[model samples]
Target: MTNVKRKAIMVSLIRKMKEKGSWTGETHIQKCTYFLEEFLRVPLNFNFILYKHGPFSFDLRDELTALRADNFIEMEPRRPFGASFMPGKVAEVLETKYSNDIDKHKEQINFIVEKLANKSVKELERVATALYVKKNEDVSKDDMVGQIRELKPHISKELAKQAVEELNDYIKEAEHNHIIL
Candidate 1:
């Protein structure tokens, strides 16, 4: 798909996520977008890397800025916390334009939004990082824990281990549900 189409889909997905009343924060939006592109084959291609809160993308941030500029989404400032996202005037039109494609992947979208959107930012950091590690496939469990701890020194070793285990379970569930191939 064209970049324009992909972005329209992203904006539409963001709007749908907001309507669910579950994914309001910037972190939730980013991670949900990541899962849509990376896992559910939505083709947003945002160049994510393992940042402080797990996979982050400057490209995605830019797209969000564009969305704000285009009035497709509104950002509500939260002081020390990051801004929350709400649907803007253009959201409904974009959503309707992309509804069929979005509906085709509703199960994966819902799974991602419901499962990860409600987690605290810290917990999301752990989960997203663990999933990143799991994606490498060759990384041993011990190595995964070490990597997670090294990246997030504040996290306990036990917690890191648990996160990896939980991520493994999620992978299995996704595969079973055909959310991932």
Candidate 2:
């Protein structure tokens, strides 16, 4: 699909997420969108790379900025430092316009958001970074924790181990559902 269409779909998807009480924060948005395109095959062409916060895409950021500019979403800074994306005035109109496409992928979107919605940003960072490590390296499950810490020295070993376990769970479910990861 064209970039324009994809952006419209993203707007609608975010609105749906908000309605479902899944719009936790920016990290939620990033990870959910990553799963939407990479695992669920929504085809938004985000060139994700293993960045500090795990899978990140400049294209996604640009699209979000454009959405803000168009008043489809608003970013509000939370106390003590992070931000959240809330639906703006135009979000409902955009959601309605793209209702059919959003509805088509609603199952995947809901599954992803529900699975990931409650995670804190730190937990998400650990999980996403661990997933990146698993995808890019040939480390065994036994050594996954150490391997992850080697790349991301700041994470506690306990958190690294937990992240590996969480990533394994996600992988297993994805495989069971025949969703390519």
Candidate 3:
């Protein structure tokens, strides 16, 4: 996709995330975009790695900075929780210009946002890390949980299991609907 199309998707994500009552922080955008690319295969072309919070893309981070610089998104301070992102003054114009491109992947975007928009940062960390491990490692379900716990010792075994289970459900649903290839 073109760079402008990618920006449109990002703008739409920020807007929908806010509308869905998400924190819309940098971490939220990072994890959601990770799922959009990895799970739904939207081809945003971000190279994600298991970072401090979860799957993080430095490229995407840079793009977000550019979006802010270009007045396509605004950072709003939320005090103790750090700053959150919001659609900027020119966001709607970009969205309008790339409406067709955005619509092509609308279902995938909405799927990710609906699944993750309301999750707490901690929850996102656990679940997204589970996905990272699942994608990057060859392991059975039980081993995946063990790996998740090992990767994030802060998370309990039960929570890791739950995250893996949730990830499995998402995969199954996506496959059923032909969202992922």
Using TM-score, give the best candidate's number. Answer: 3
Error of 2 at 34 (Å): 2.0
**Candidate 3 lDDT over residue span 21-66, tens digit each:** 9999999999999999988889899999878877899999999999
User: Total clashing residue pairs per candidate?
Assistant: 0, 0, 0
Q: Which residues of candidate 3, in runs, are more than 4 Å off?
A: none
True lDDT of residue 167, candidate 2: 79
Q: In model 2, which residue pairs have backbone atoms overlapping below 3 Å?
A: none
Q: lDDT tens string, model 1, 1-181?
A: 6666666677766766776775478788878877776766666678889886888888888988988998988988776677888878877787788777667667777777777777778888887887777666679889999988887889899999988887778778888888762
lDDT by residue for model 2 over 1-181, one digit each (tens)? 7765676777766766677675457678888888777666777898898776778888888889988998988888877658778778788787777777767766777677777766777777888777667767778875788877877788999889888888788778877887552
RMSD of each: 1.9, 2.4, 1.1
Global local distance difference test of model 2: 0.76
lDDT of 3: 0.91
Best by lDDT: 3
Q: At residue 91, what lDDT does model 2 achieve?
A: 81
Clashing pairs in 1: none
Poorly placed runs, candidate 1 (over 4 Å): none
